[model samples]
Target: MRSKGERLRRRRSAGSRLSTGSASELQQYSELLHASPTNPYAPFDSKIDWEVARWAKLRGPGSNAMTELLKIEGVCDSLGLSFKDTDALNRMIDNLPGRPAFKREEVVIADEAFEVYHRDVIECIRALYGDPEFAKDLILLPERHYADADKTIRMYSDMHTGKWWWNTQKAVERETPGATIVPVIISSDKTQVTLFGNKTAYPIYMTIGNLPKEIRRKPSQGGHVLLGYLPTTRLEHIVNKASRRRTLANLFHSCVSRILRPLKKAGEFGVPMASGDGIYRRLHPIFATFVGDYPEQLLVTGIKTGECPKCPVPHNELGEYGDRDKLRDIEQVLNALSSITDGNPLVFVKACAAAGIKPVQHPFWEGLPYVDIFQTITPDILHQLYQGVMKHIISWVTKACGAAEVDARCRRFPPNHSIRLFTKGISTLSRVTGREHSQMCQILLGLVVDVCLPDGHSTATLIKAVRAILDFCYLAQYPAHTDETLNHLDEALQQFHQAKHIFVLLGIRSDFNIPKLHSLLHYIASIKCFGTTDNYNTEYTERLHIDFTKDAYRATNHKDEYPQMTKWLTRREKVLRHEKYIKWRVAGCPPPDVPQTDGMPDPRDLGSRPHLRMTRHPTVKAVPVSTVKLQYGAQFFEAAFARFVVQYHEPRWTAFQVEQAAANIYLPFQRLPVFHKIKFWIKDPFHRGLGSETSDAVHCSSIWA
Candidate 1:
């Protein structure tokens, strides 16, 4: 085998030949090649190097190579067989290249201690930029305007297509010409590490809008980076309840501010970075969006639980919808926070309460440029819509129409290919999820069809209100939206508002002062500013919790697992990045080229045309016709098969002729092939052709019934 130095020289020579696109790109690449710790690839030159790489690649989920080797040794000892030593494995892993260490910082609030673990934000950004896999799908510039053949402006679909991106691009260009705006998206959520225990992890994740949403949403793609894991403390040390809450909020803001401090200067002064297209650009990393559920939103913005995070709407008037209130001004909030300088906690709390915010000394977004903290709080379909609004609607409607009757209707509802069958009814479900709420929405209106209401209330009005809310829910989730669809969305909300008083008259709800209901009023404005709801949906971030937090925690011992989890995550990332580098080298490290945009079929243009698909092998190779009828519940199988045969043989056959031919026709084979399920794929009309394949399966097995 070649020596390590020889392998390094050969790899560098080959990489140098790849086109750099410009002088800036060449300079950056040269620096990366010579840098001590920032080099993109590691040289595998010996038997031990190959062994380590193989071990990293073959490790199982929530496990390391060392653990697996130890297990193997135990099994071999039991069988009287010899096994190799694991010291070499451990040594090789430790010596692996390009592994960044985590920093542990101790934070104190209200005389209580907490731990915050994090990595360098700028270093993480550079690592992501240097990855070759992202280069294939990176979107570097804003798509300000795009029109169709009819000259009609299309709806916003991607993050770059939104007005916020375009406005920020223009602003940055004015300040520093030829500078690129990198839209940074940050998300954080607390998740339980174990199923039965109270142990939990609060992880902060970061990604960029420079990548396509299709790529950024998938956790396996490594597009979403784990910035840090915050301490999950209840702060029981503080005796006063109010003081404890204030201290917890302050701790959160302080930890987040520390993690994101690098962006403050980088957002104003451009940093030189190499783009996916082999071109160097002066990139300004702006904090453009924050994705989280309602509780996190309140915590991040320093707002109380009952108030709107995006606007100045009063808590009591949230149910009354009409003209939108003014947006929360950051400067005004800061001034309010600074108004009381006596350092008295009571006076500070009063000043913040007057401003409708919590007593947070400094919010995470205090110094970030071109970012409206309120606007950054995006719409969450999971918590706000499905879990929040839909849950309330179900409860109100069930009470008004009687739960027994609704449960009977739900049990009697037929099975569908697209909609889930809630066999036990939704009334008894303890903790319903967003997915269950979605399935319930499909059959909600059907359950109340022509059903009478109690108290002589109008059933039509209830049906109308439910229908309008469902319409709004479905429309708000559209992958793409236009001027016309946005108007329809507004109309749906207005219709709901006009018909919502039926619940009050029926004594189901005293008032409509629901914050979730009020949130619907701002969907149009949010969509216009930040593209569609899916761009920052909390559902994607919730999915990331499994890979980034829960799984990482599982790979560690119960005591002080934060450091172990962070280190495991770093090693996993390094392994994946090195795999990508090896693949690129094997492919000859081709120069990056501009993506072809013309002549590509637009997904929106392709209407809802479904194509049937099935397995290549038959589910049942030889099942008798009689068996199919008796076991599979196909009572009219013979008649249906005869009619199909007659229609296939004779065009425009009458029913009478079909019946006559059915009597004469006989089975050519005693046994017939059976397929248990069939799938249908329809092209989605949004988000271009990237994520447009909508599929549903129909199972024909008797057990499914």
Candidate 2:
């Protein structure tokens, strides 16, 4: 039997253990904690109430307690804790699972200086690997193919299952035997920090493709991490506009190169990193995809604006549909960039122009191995499809069919639970979102169905064109695809192109030189290489800006806010990680396993069958039938109710008999319960998981005659 002191010592040591590791590893962690006292999850006194610290930190930024840390002391004092001071609480908050610190660096590009706040990419990658939440779902090796019993390639659902990952995996294995490829996905967007301000933040986010798309796409899942904040400062110091643009482009590359410099060595050679499963694997992180809008894509790939970033398709020929020109060659681009080394600016400019690229020397991907910058630029559905092509289509349709007619048809259209009513029509609406465009797509073809086209230019062809484009948009977003679906996608685009000449003949537009329309040609290729469009959709990143940029900025004092924003993000991440850790401990620290279904039917598999729900309590209980006819505008209510009753009683009743019975039958009740509205929750096949719920009012009133 052990003595009381020995037992107490063992208990204290157990409490101090931060991770599930060997005694030597625990000692090493203890040493590291002591060495870096500011490290979150540092050792704390046994007497300190961790429950209080968890509550306080979990409040997150913009919380009342975050604004006033002193209030937490008061709460602790009320609880009569041993450590009730603000300083102790601060220490405890700092002692949660911490994030990598941001390093502020001054980057000078062509005599212009700017500040860039960034974290180490390798450190961030390792941190993600260490996360238990991510590790369980992480795909360490690429899935070559998943075939049915008949040996047919059936499912292409994730990036790992795509051709790019499989090909890249094979290449990496050939170079470094037994090496695992970690596909790094990068996204950046410039956003306003405040509602009314010149202040802006250019945030760059990074996530690995190892995680499942469902997890990667959700901001709440914590799959995405803030890689850095690029300088938003406009170079007002440079007098020449051309020079400024060149300098700005160079600065972007410079900053990105600095942030991702570590990956050069790490990608070529493997790094032994522990995954969420607590097993160390030799992982090689490589740049696989760059998710951005058109402008950002141009910036990353050094392509001039109004040019295709993925391929060498001429600007004039973008609208022409056939086989697209071959993809941009990296060797030719590098040679053009290298022209500057000869000390001839004119030669560099001409060479870059000949190569159809911006005059950007030493792009971010210059030294990165196995990274084709042009191919890495993924298709953006939100921008290119919905906002771009759909917007243009709507404008052309409005011109072909007058706005008044469109709006009139829109207003008169019957309301369905799933479709937007467009009460005032889409013509008057300004700054429509991708979501709105999608809603419009649902009814766009219907609105122009029977409408007369000016000059008798074949309204049937117009209808076909509109239908084809809508089909392409919906099909492009499928969560899984096969060869058959890819062919269908191709046919949809072909159908639209074949019918698009009506727009030109109608004088809506002279040519189809639109870049967004041309981008449609590459969808099949991109989907084959990178899986579904949802994997790299900018919609998820736009959602991320709310939490990572906007909320983080709001938490700050609004002066030199990047530092505070990064720190706040770090603290919030720590709090969340610690919460998970605590939960794991409580659950007996079960070994990490691949996520298994609970045998319940997948929410995605729930078909178009709508689930109807009505309030148990009636809106107006025992309302007189006369009031329903007069006030509720149900002129035929009494007759309709009688018919319903007759139908319900007599299954085989004739129509003539039902009408006669409805007119003569005496009503059972003078007053009846009425419900104002009913909700229909119907599954949207395009969107997986939770179905959409829309309400339809029950009224006899008609908006249209």
Best by lDDT: 2
Task: Please provide, for model 2 over 1-705, each residue's C-alpha lDDT reduced to its tens digit, 9 standing for 90 to 100.
Answer: 222223322433211212344222222333444633342333433224545555555543445544365455476456544445545655565665466878999998776678999999998898776666565566765554444555465457789767788777667766766666789999999988788967789999999998888888866567788999999867888899988888888999999999999999999987777765556667889999999999899999888888889899889999988564368988998889888899999999999998889888788898898898888888899999989999999989988899999999899887565678898988888989999998998889988898998887788999999999999999999988888888889999999999999999899899999888998998888888889998999999999898889988887788888888887777767655555543444455542332211222323333534477688897778988888777877889878878999999996999999998888878888898877667755445556443223344442332222
Model 1 accuracy (lDDT, Cα): 0.75
| Inter-residue clash pairs, candidate 2 | 41-95, 41-96
lDDT of 1 by residue, 597-647 (tens): 112333333353447878999888888888888889887888898889998
User: What C-alpha lDDT values do all the predictions have?
Assistant: 0.75, 0.77
TM per candidate: 0.82, 0.82
> Model 2's lDDT to the true fold?
0.77
